[model samples]
Target: MKKILLPALLLIVLALAACGNKQEEPAKEDTPSKEQGTSDTITYQSEEGPVEVPANPQRVVVLSSFAGTVHEFGVNLVGAESWSKDNPSFDSFLKDVEEVSDENIEKIIELEPDLIIGLNTIKNIDKLKEIAPTVTYTYGKVDYLTQQIEIGKLLNKEKEATEWVDAFKARAQQAGEDIKAKIGKDSTVSVIEEFDKQIYVFGDNWGRGTEILYQEMKLAMPEKVKEMTKKDGYYALSAEVLPEFAGDYIILSKSDTGDNSFLETETYKNIPAVKNDQVYQVNTAEFSFNDAYTLDNQLDFFIKSFLGTK
Candidate 1:
């Protein structure tokens, strides 16, 4: 009777151990099953169509001039185009990032980026695709506010981008009110730049702060200036005829040797803005930047230059 009782007890112990082992098996399977369901990538619909990009891209490469926007979004940038490299705000980032160009496909491959970004107008899309999943944006496909939001979506940071947009708009709107009070509500603001032999007036997009001076600040534009440049992004002018486009206030941007000594010339000096000392000369390379970082700096400049408050 004692031997029979011992054997039955042994069988019960084995049965309990088997149940414990079965319980552990499901936990081990849970992790891999989750991984299989949610892979490393998320599908982002690009202009080229839907493409799977790393959900959290670690190494990013930008093949266009919009690197500043990427950096502002707090992404890891391994490579970028050097259009804004000289800007002091970008000096630190440029130090660590490789300067990429269309001709430098080999260098891009060496960087081993998880993703590559470029303008839709960028060449070598097929070659770039061989390296990694690539996304492209059209140059004027959207305004600055919408473009940033779109970029955030592409990078899987939509919430962050939306937060920034809301905050920036609030600040910009307030700045606009201040500007109107200080500079007069009816005052017209003009954005003009000199590049090489050309003198051009700009519209609300691009890098001339038109969005800030005109759109956000509620500033008016000279009718002739508006008629000429409202459709085209810019209008070219001869030095002699610049007075026609001059406004109550003018923001002048000059590139290296691009000014053509126009500021010193009687034609430019005779403009009402020049005589009233309302023409603000901003660094062309600096002002040409239209990214999130540059916009913040420019807003401060407008307030100080026009409102005399820091």
Candidate 2:
């Protein structure tokens, strides 16, 4: 009896030992190793500091700007600010995306985004940080082209961003030369916008094709206008002062609310640009973005408007 009991006990102990070995092996083939788990995330240098972000983020949210850029990069978006929701190009892609209210923190938190991109001026930034990793950009701190590149770097797509910038620069240079050939090289251009209460003249980087006109297109600005706006980025003037800022060619940006009656007035009509039929009116909704999307659209507009060839 003792011999039989000893053999049975030995068999049980051997079976238990085999099970313990299997558990200790940690199922390496089926389970992710520590190194593999660590690889799922990466640290990015942001305006605030180094931040850990997903190595391959599947959900991203853009709050105030750069929605166009993110879309251009083929990244998946989980939400967007109300402004992008109205963009015709973004409307379809954002149909399912939640519209984040810039004024409301709860709206953003509900989206469960892995990342959030916005302008530095956005309100409630502290609350936004609580929801996800947030990165913010200050407009005018860099040129539009550089800003886009910075955003691309933040998203880990610097290569694509740089490639696009190179291509766009080449295209813009060609367009500038073509425009200068069509219109006299000496001809000057101005970018102006009429808001509800004020008129503004912009320099090279404040959107409304100013970058393309003054920087990329190499279009000249009137000496007086340059002296006033070159440092401030923009000059605000009354309707009566339109002629002072007007150039040989004017790109006028208007929003839905601004009154266009000023254009009919003799003051505006008498400007050389208006008299020469060189005032190209563009919608603020379409022309205000300082992103690649707006740049591409405005380039075509510049060609058609200036060269009369699409």
Candidate 3:
């Protein structure tokens, strides 16, 4: 009887050990990462510094005046940092957002945000992280379209972002076709700006020009402009070089106070674009700044400009 009891007890112990092992094993394949608390995890890289994000952030605080991405993602914004040049349209989108400070770490901490997003150039990232997960984006990382996609990825709305871009592209293409029909194919245009008494011609690669010149009209690149862009990619070039690399049309951009004073100058008068009265002025807000809503409006105006309806 003792031998039989001993063997039975051994079998029961082995069974118990097996059950314990099974319980200890983690169900890797069966469980989803979302349920594993990965949604709050924040991950971002930028020229500014390393940012660690909390998992599945609920309330987010944004510390930048440019909240174009918020509208794109339709995320609830808890706060935004005020910039000197905040766009008025941003007010409608950010009606719910509170104004955070550039230096006020305590204010950000009080919000209890799950994450924080801002430009890497901002100096408050480390301080902000003590309060919540922080992510930074470099300005040079993407063109405006790609930037929207990146923002979507961070917000976990990548599909929506992709669709938005596709819609914009289709609209821009249709607008482009309508525009080219008016200006005629093979017409070349220059993006000109006179700021602070200095003339600047943005290359085809310029953010605004890239959309209008590359995407909209499919205009040809100027040889000299291409040469300058070969190095730093794109920049504001001198307006004085207009005659040396004259274009068929000069789309001039002006400040609030700019007038025909350039027309009074001999150099501006001598330029082929000016001589033909081909100079066209665009608003600074629409073209100079590239945001989701602003770009949409600018694209329409560019279509009009090309159609000769402006």
Candidate 4:
């Protein structure tokens, strides 16, 4: 009985020792199921539920003023809408990209975009999805820098995108400091654009408004500018009320070529900006809310107009 018990104990000890000498978990299978991120749909937070995108969206279409944001991720955009000239706060190099147009929906469909980007309130999201997977963004409603960061997450380039923004912030800070020293601390500024319907003075909450108030030439925003928000946060005002919205200096944005000789109207001549030559007309189609290529132009424009010699 003792002999049998000793042999059994020896066998059990050998089995326990064998179990302790286990191997690794077969290198985790090297499969998508083992990955932390989703294998099917890449998820992103939005106004609605999680916005899902394909894993490797090769052909992409962008219809927002976030061309810089997408460009930060090193994505070779298959399609992009023309740069929005209405908001001069963004980079303008995007205008040179030959982006697609909403009017040419048939052309966009032919591109076979894997992902379509648009503002959260884009006109035809449902229709866009019928042609491709669309991701809606609340762009104009948020801060300019915030929009860039959020889009970074969507593109799975959060780290790289943040680096780009950090560089941009540095650029903004340096530009602001330089312009402040050149323009003098007492200087004030305003921005106005003539849209299809009416003239608009960008508000602090919007892109161009924020750029003037916070970036570029640092200046105090008048109370009238804040009131111009009008609930939805932006409103168009008639140029007749230029005095009401006018500041010590006004940066006027115009569509198409930079020539403003055509706008020598009687009313335009009387405005303090035009009268004193305090109004500087910038080419919107080339710069506003554009992309990296033209961002230097905006920065330079601020320097030349409000700051000093280039």
Q: How do all models score by TM-score?
A: 0.84, 0.83, 0.69, 0.70
Over 25-115, each residue of candidate 4 has an lDDT whose tens digit, in order, gives: 2232211121125775577655555666766566678765555557657765777654432334433434444457655778788888887
Residue 263 of model 4, lDDT score: 60
lDDT of 2 at 6: 11
Q: What's the best-to-worst order under TM-score? A: 1, 2, 4, 3
Comparison by TM-score, 1 against 2, better one? 1
**What does candidate 2's lDDT look like per residue over 1-310, in tens digits?**
1110110000011000000010022232422111112476656665566666665677898876677788776678988866667655556578888887667777777778888887665678888788888887654445567666766766677788879888888888898999898888998888787655677776665656777777777888888777776554566789898888888989887666667788789999889888888888887655666566667778889988988876
Which residue pairs show backbone clashes in model 4? 88-288, 90-289, 91-290, 91-291, 92-290, 92-291, 93-294
lDDT of 3 by residue, 123-221 (tens): 766787777666665543444466566566666666777798888878877777776677676667766655455554445434444454654556755
State the weakest 10-residue window (summed lDDT) of model 2: 9-18
Q: What's the CA error at residue 215 for candidate 1, in Å? A: 2.0
Tens digit per residue, CA lDDT, model 1, 170-243: 88889888888877888988888776567777655546566667666778888878888665456678989999
Q: Which order, best to worst by lDDT? A: 1, 2, 3, 4
